[model samples]
Target chain A: MQSLIVDLGERSYPIYIGQNILCEALIKPFIKGNQVMVVTNDTIAPLYLDHLLAHLSGLSVDVTVLPDGESYKDLTHLNLIFDNLLKNKHNRTTTLIALGGGVVGDMTGFAAASYQRGVDFIQIPTTVLSQVDSSVGGKTGVNHPLGKNMIGAFYQPQLVVADISVFATLPDRELSAGIAEVIKYGLIYDYSFFCWLEENIERLVARDADILMQAIHRSCEIKAEVVAQDEKEAGIRAWLNLGHTFGHAIETHQGYGNWLHGEAVAAGTMMALSLSVQMGWISIEDMDRVRRLFEKANLPVTPPKNMSSNDFIDLMSVDKKVLNGQLRLVLLKTLGEAVVTADYSKEKLMDVLSA
Target chain B: MQSLIVDLGERSYPIYIGQNILCEALIKPFIKGNQVMVVTNDTIAPLYLDHLLAHLSGLSVDVTVLPDGESYKDLTHLNLIFDNLLKNKHNRTTTLIALGGGVVGDMTGFAAASYQRGVDFIQIPTTVLSQVDSSVGGKTGVNHPLGKNMIGAFYQPQLVVADISVFATLPDRELSAGIAEVIKYGLIYDYSFFCWLEENIERLVARDADILMQAIHRSCEIKAEVVAQDEKEAGIRAWLNLGHTFGHAIETHQGYGNWLHGEAVAAGTMMALSLSVQMGWISIEDMDRVRRLFEKANLPVTPPKNMSSNDFIDLMSVDKKVLNGQLRLVLLKTLGEAVVTADYSKEKLMDVLSA
Candidate 1:
């Protein structure tokens, strides 16, 4: 087992990565109270809820299974979790365990954050996208009809248990989607890691457990460091959303769950690279390498064909990155570096869109 | 003008209490962004929205008026604020100003807490209940159908401006409701303040600016100290909910807004005192004195005659104060001191309910 700590002072918790460690003893210490509620979606509840129940068997555990999809990540579904909690009479001491992918993790984390003003919860992220990114950062929320992740909280979890064995059951496309975030670490901060990803792309796609473990571990380490410095995203944390600005536009336009979050991010990263190349900040060869790496991982390499430049601008305008009505984009300075600023010209942005 | 600071380290904010001090100069320093969205209810928007707009004339300000009453403090109303924000393309830099009473303040605070994961907001509480209690501490959220304040966050405000002049427009019942919180500070922590209230109840009832200012200032001070010690209600802060357990049941049973929050709290405090008397923790005379003080302030002294004991027990059982499935009550130790415990006898509790 590999372990890492998100050093957020008192709000910090440990992340444990391994295969088949979802047994009771490993999860017992993190259960702060006797009342435990497990929040998962229908897709995952059938696959792993029983395994989780085996660990929580001796204690009082209730389960709330929401419909499985990004589309289901809204206030209506969020209320189901709260309804279950209220019905079961869960208290402040109750511990909520999010036992699915990013959607489940986001819902449970938020429910825990607001339930009784806040409660402790554990993340058992089953998807690579969640294990590597969303689960580690304490970023939990639902999407609004107008935008993605528009409603949520930065509530950290007591523990995140990422069992690598679950990847064997992940659909091929979902596995590929998760790799987009894994690739994000390289494009934004680690040049050598970007190179490493280029070399190891085939092994990751083949579900090679050793290579997959390496990817999840490295992604979490990068994320933990960024979150520690700016947990609230006041400064450098914005860099973590490099592909998110355009990606959220795609998600919002295409409607959530129609396109996977990581898939949209993959395409959005490509657009960001095109803008970077237009600015002469990164060479076309580097941009190609980035695109080829994503292509190798089976991720999308362009924005959806139907989305117009005006649509992108309109959708992106509502982004949280908008500061004083100016859209701030996170662009690559080089293969392993990125910068968040509103300095790019409209002409350059238009060129990338027109292309 | 009188000012007191809630010393919560990085989250600290000031509470300014005075008459007709809602001018631009007093509020401008706290506006972090050029875009300001003031969230007010229908009743208050017609009354004070223009006055607030006058102070914010130069900035890009948007006004969202929600329906008035506690029943409107739900997710649907909260989404109205979000819709206005997204429609106006308000960014993370935009500041939300909650410009009504407790319902508006609570909804706006929760919206700011969750919008874009988090944003800065200032409180311009127009009611004594909000100025004295909800606005000072960071306990911001909306209610769920199952329970009051069941869904929310502990998000603080940037500043709190309590213009005492607004009290002149307050209905007699609302003014009396506000005094319930004023009396709470004394009942929970300060004996001398309780005696002071006994002496000046008539002046406060008449909305004497000088006496009302004194009451609001002291309440903020006592609340700030308790909150600074335990911002998240891990310990001593629970004492602040002396009458809230029974009170929340009333709110939940009667439906939110049927009985005002302060009114429910006033009657609930009497129940807690009755329990204290049964426990031999306080004399019957002290309980009667407490009841008389609330009556003097025109606050409720007894639980609504229609609510059954079983309903109260069932409702209170789901309170946030319940731990390990046991209900914890905040009971008076003597006159001013209070203790939160589950150690009371079941028979004695039954006796109080039966009586």
Candidate 2:
């Protein structure tokens, strides 16, 4: 097992990675009290909720399996968890275990943050996407009608348990979804990791343990180093959102659940690369490479057919990166290197966007 | 104006106390952004919202007055603020001004904290209760069905504008409610302040600005000291909740909005004193003095009718203060000092609890 610390001082926590870390004794020390609430979703509920439940057995535990979708990640669903915790008499000391992918982790982290003005929560991320991305960052919230993650807190979890074994049962579509985000780590900040993912795409799809584990670990190392430096996403951290501004617009425009988040982000990354080329920061050859690498992973490379270009731009204006009036984009200047800037003009953006 | 700084580093804020600060240029320099949302209630909206709106006419602003009452201090109310903010296309940089009592301040502050992962907010407290307590602590949240202030954060405002002139039109019952929290400042951590309140209780009720402002400044100083030591309520901060444990039970049991929160706290403070004497922490003469003070302020001194002892105890269990299995209580050792301990026999607690 490999233990990585987030280094947030008093709020700092650990992310344990390995095949059997879930059953390992390292985590029991952080469990704060007797009551525990396991928050997962229907898609992930039938698979590994029982494995987590068996481990939580002599301790008082309650499990809530919400409907599986991004649309459900709103006030109604958050309230369901709140209702269960309160009805079951969970207190501030009660620990919450988020036992699924990004949606489950985000919602659970937020519910934990808001429940009783905050409580302790451990992340038991079951999907590759969560293991590599969402579990590492302290960002937590659901999408709103006006924007995605427009309401949330920068609340860190006490522990993140990335159990690789749980990903074995992910559906082809979901597994592919996780691969998109995995490729994102390479595309934005590491040309070498990009080259590595380019070479190992098939093995990862085949679920080769060594390659998959390395991808998870390296991605986490890169992310943890970035997050440790900028916990509040004030400056350098915004670079991590390479495809998210476009990703959020696509997801909101596509009506949340119609496309998985990472799938939208996959297509969004293509758009970001295209814009990077239009802005003269990167070569067209590099954009083609990003598209080809995504294709090899079976990821979507085009925007969803339903959303209007006008609507997409409007949605992007509300992105967290758009702090002032202008929208900021995290674009790639080269493989393994990214830049956060809003210097592109309307004409250039619209020309590239019309594609 | 009484300038008290609640120091929490980056989250630190200043609470300003005086009459006509809102209409004067005194509060203008602290106002940061152009876009502002004024959150108020029907009772306070009619009384003070116009004055606030008039003062804010030079800036880009909107006013939303929610249904009047403590019951309105919930997620639904918070959602209303979000809905309006989003509908107005107010970006994360917009400032939110809470222009009522504790209910308005709490919900607006929380809305600021969670809306787009936080925005700037200023406290324009119109009520005497808010000017002294809620405005300074940086504690913001709505009530849950299970308990009060159970879901909140320690989010500070940029500046607090307390206009004493707004209190001239305040109702007698509401004015008395404010006195209850005023008396609390003396009870928990300041015996001299307690003695002072005892001597000048009638003067404070008569709207003596010198005494009222003194009471506000001293209360803020004691609260500021406790919050500075433990901003997150990990220890010392909970002492500020001396009467709130039982106070919340009374508010929750009486069907919220039935009795003013300060009035409920007034009665609960007496109960805490009665138990303190029973536990040999204070003299019987102290309880007598507390009773006399509440009477002079025209505040309730008994648990409201129809609330059972069992209901109060059950309610306290879900409080943010009860860590693990212990029901932590902050009791006065003397008028000027307090102690927090869970060391009490169930039988002993039952005697005072069952009354």
Candidate 3:
């Protein structure tokens, strides 16, 4: 097992990565209270709920199974977790365990943050998308009808246990979706890692255990470093949103769940790179290299054909990244380095959106 | 104006208590962004919205008027704040101003805490219940169906402007409700303040500005002291919830809005004092003194006739104060000091509840 800490001072916690390590002993130390509520989804419950519960023995345990999918990530569904916690008489000391993908992790973490004005929570991210991205950062929230992740909290979890063995059951499309975020860490901060991804992308796509482990570890390490420097996304942490602003527009435009978060991010990352090339910050060849890598991972490289420049402009205007009416995008200064800026040309942005 | 600080290091903020100080200059310094959203209820909007807006010139401002009452303090109405924020293109830097009683303040503060994963908010608490209690502490959240304030966050505001002049327009019933909390400060921490209330309770009920100001100031000071030592209620902060566990049970049982929070708290305080007497902590005279004070203020000193011991036990079991399946109640060891424990005999608790 490999472990890395997201150093947030007193709020710091460790993330454990390994195959089939979701056992009682690994999770026991983090349980701050005897009463535990494991929040997962219908899809994940059929596969991993009992498996996770079997390990949570000798404790007062309860489970709340929500319907699966990104569309369910709303205040309505988030309330269900709270209902279960309150119905089961979970108190301030009770701990909540999130046992599914990003949607489950985000909602469960939020539930913990607000339940009786905060409680301890553990993140057991099942999908690659969650393990590499959502579960690592303390960013937990449910989406509003108008925007994605519009309502939430920056609540840290007590522990994050990422079991790589779960990926064996992930659908091919979902695996590709998760790699989009894995590729994000490389593009934003690590040049050498991006190069490594170029060489290992094929093995990662093929589900090679050794290659997948390395990618997940490297991705978490980069994320941990960024989050440590900026826990609340005040400064350098904004770099993590390299493709998210555009991706959120895609997700909102398509009405969430129609396109997976990672799929949108993959396509959004491509648009950002294309705009980077136009700004002369990077060469066309540099953009193409990342484009090919995303293609190789079976991810989308462009926005949906139905979406136009108007859709991008309208949706992007409401993004959380927009400050004082200016929309900030994380664009590449080079292949591996990124900057969050509204300094780009509007006409060029229009060209990319129109294309 | 009399000002005191809730010293929470970097999260610290000032509470300004005076008559009609809700002006642009006092509020403008606290607003971190150019965009502002004032969240108030229907009752307060017609009275103060235009007056407040008249002062907030030159900044981009919007208003969301929710229906007045505790019944509306749920996730559904809380969503209206988020909806208004998104509809108006409020960004991460936009500040939310909570401009009503506890319900509006709680929902708005929670909205600010969660909107875009947190933003700046200023508390312009118009009601006495809000000014003396809810607005002073960072405890913000909406109620769940299963419980009252079962979901929320401890999110502080950038500034708090308690305009004592607003009490001129407050109804007699609500005025008395607010004093219940003011009296609480005395019972739990300040014997001198309790004596002062004994002498000046009538003047406060008659809305004497000087006496009301003194009461609000003292209540805020005691609350600030407790909150500064334990911001998250891990220790000393729990004492501030002296009657909340019992009060929440009454509020939940009667249904929100049927009984004002402070009225329920006033009645709940009597129950706690009764329990304290049964436990051989405080004498019967001490309990009667508080009961007479509540009577003078026109606050209820007992629970509803319909509620039984079973109702109290059933509802109190789900309170946030319950730890590890043990229900911890904040009880008085004497007239001026309080302690939170589950150490009292259950039979003794039933004696008080059944009475």
Candidate 4:
């Protein structure tokens, strides 16, 4: 198993990844077991909750499942987790284990962070989107009315167990969604990873074990390094948000959970690349590479036809990245290099939108 | 005006104290007017919200009046604040300002810290308990089923406005509770401050302007220094929890929000002294002086008749100070110095209890 530590001082924790690694022993150190709460959603619980619960059989584990969707990543859905914990009388020592994809992971992580101030929780990420992204960083939270992850904490999980076996159960649509985040790492900071993704897109789409492991491992390394530098999403951590500024706008406009996070990011990344090309930061060839690789991964490369530039800009304003009402866009110079800049002119933004 | 700065790198903020210091010019910079939410308990809003809101006259201010008391300082209460922030279309730029005492301050601070991931919040602390303790620490959170502040964060407020005039309307009982924390500062880290408190307890109980200011300033200094050393409550910052270990048990056993926090803390301080003397860390005469001072200030100097030693032990087991189910007590070695030690024997605890 490969592990990465999110160095957040007292809040530091470890993220572990490998095939067939979700057994109890890996996460026992973090579980305060008189009462344990497992938070997941319908989509995940039916598929993998039993395998996860099998580990908690000896312990007094309470499982609570919410409807699976990004739209449910809000306070209303968060309360469902809390309602169970409260009903079960789960205390500070009651550990929360999030056993699902990013939507479930983010919501569960947030539920742990906010329930009774905070509680211990571990992540058992089932989807690639989660194993490589949400599970690694201490970033956990639900979406606010204004934006996704608008309500959250840089709360690290006590332990993160990413088991590749769970991914076989993921639907094709979900599998493709997860790939968007995997591709994000290459576009933001690792040129070689981008090229690697370009070469291995077919295998990854086919769920080739060796290729998938390599992608998850490398994505986590890049993420772990960025998170180490800015645990609080203050600076370099924002780089991990490549495609997210526009991706969030898409997700919000599409009404969260409607568009899988990875799909939104896939299209958002294409726009970022186009914007980058318009800004003269990257050649058109770079944009084409991103589009082709994303397409090969079965990720959407275009915005929904109904989306207007005006609507996109309005939706983008609510993102956490927009500071003092100025919309900040995360555009790419090339794969493996991303910058969060609002230096682009409206003329450029319009050109990309009008494209 | 007296000000203390909690230098927590990017999270650092200021705590200002004085009479009628609520000028718009003083508060506007910290007020993110895109949306401003003021959280206070029912008891405080009737007494001070109109007066406070009058200051933010030109800004878009929204007031949320929660039920009064510490029992209300739960996720149930915090969600009310978060819900209000969103239901009103408040965005990332929205600022939250906590009003009222520690309960309100802590809940609001947590609300601000978790709302939209985090938002800027200012503290208009009306009660002395908050100004000297909760208001300065950025330790924002609500109570948990098993522990006091078991769920919380070191979320700093943008500015802490301690308008002394709010003291004029304070209930005599509540004022005495605030003094408990004021005296706590003197007992924990500053012998000179203890001497100061010993001499000025009477003037403070009667709410003398000059003496109160001195007490508030000195308390802020001690807290500010400890917070500076350990912003996240990892090391020496634990010392600032002087009477809290015992006090929380009392509050919890009695049912939270039952006794005023200061009243319970006042008794807890006496317990700390008794424990200190039992361990030979504090002198008998010093213990007597501690009791005498609490009496003079009209604060409780003994644990309530209702709670047994087992009750205290059970309640304290979940305290933030308690590690791995073992209790860590903060004992006063000298009138103004405190230490958190796990060395107390069960026999010693029984002896103190039976004594």
Per residue, candidate 4 scores C-alpha lDDT tens digits across A137-226 of 877887766667767886778888877888878899988898999888988998888888888999999999989888988888888888
Winner on TM-score between 1 and 4 is 1
Candidate 2 iRMSD in angstroms: 1.7
- Quote the B-chain TM-score, candidate 4: 0.96
lDDT tens string, model 2, A1-355?
Answer: 7778888889999988888667636666778798889999998888887777877756888998899888888877888898898888788789999998888999999888888778889999888888999999788887678777877888999999887888778887878888888888887777899899889988998888888889998888888888999998878888788888888888888788888888998998888888888878889888888888788778899997776779777888767776557778898888778889988767877876687
lDDT of 1 by residue, B1-355 (tens): 9999999999999889999999999889888789999999889988899989999978999999999999999888899999898889888888999998999999999999999888989999999999999998899999988899999999999999999988778899998898999999999999999999999999999888999999999999999999999999989999999899999999999999999999999999998999999899999998988888999999988899898889888898889888897899999999999999999998888777666
TM-score of chain B of 3: 0.99
Candidate 2 docking classification: medium
Which scores higher on lDDT, 2 or 4? 2
Instruction: Arrange candidates by DockQ, descending.
Output: 3, 1, 2, 4
Residue A177 displacement (Å), model 2: 1.7
Give lDDT for model 1.
0.91
Worst 10 residues of 4 chain B by lDDT: B317-326
lDDT of 2 by residue, B196-312 (tens): 998898899999998888888888888888889998788878777778888888988988899898998888888888888888888998789889899999999999778788998
| TM-score of chain A taken by itself, candidate 3 | 0.99
Model 4: per-residue lDDT, tens digit, B1-355?
8887878788788878898888878888887646689898888889888877887877677889999888888767787887687566566678888889998989888888887677889998888888888898788887765566756666888999888999888888888888888878878888888887888877888888988888888888888889888876657888877777778888877888788888988888777778788888889998888788888878888888987888876666656665544677888777777888888767877666555
Q: Candidate 1 chain A — worst ten consecutive residues by lDDT sum?
A: A319-328
Top candidate on DockQ is 3
Quality of candidate 2 docking, DockQ: 0.66
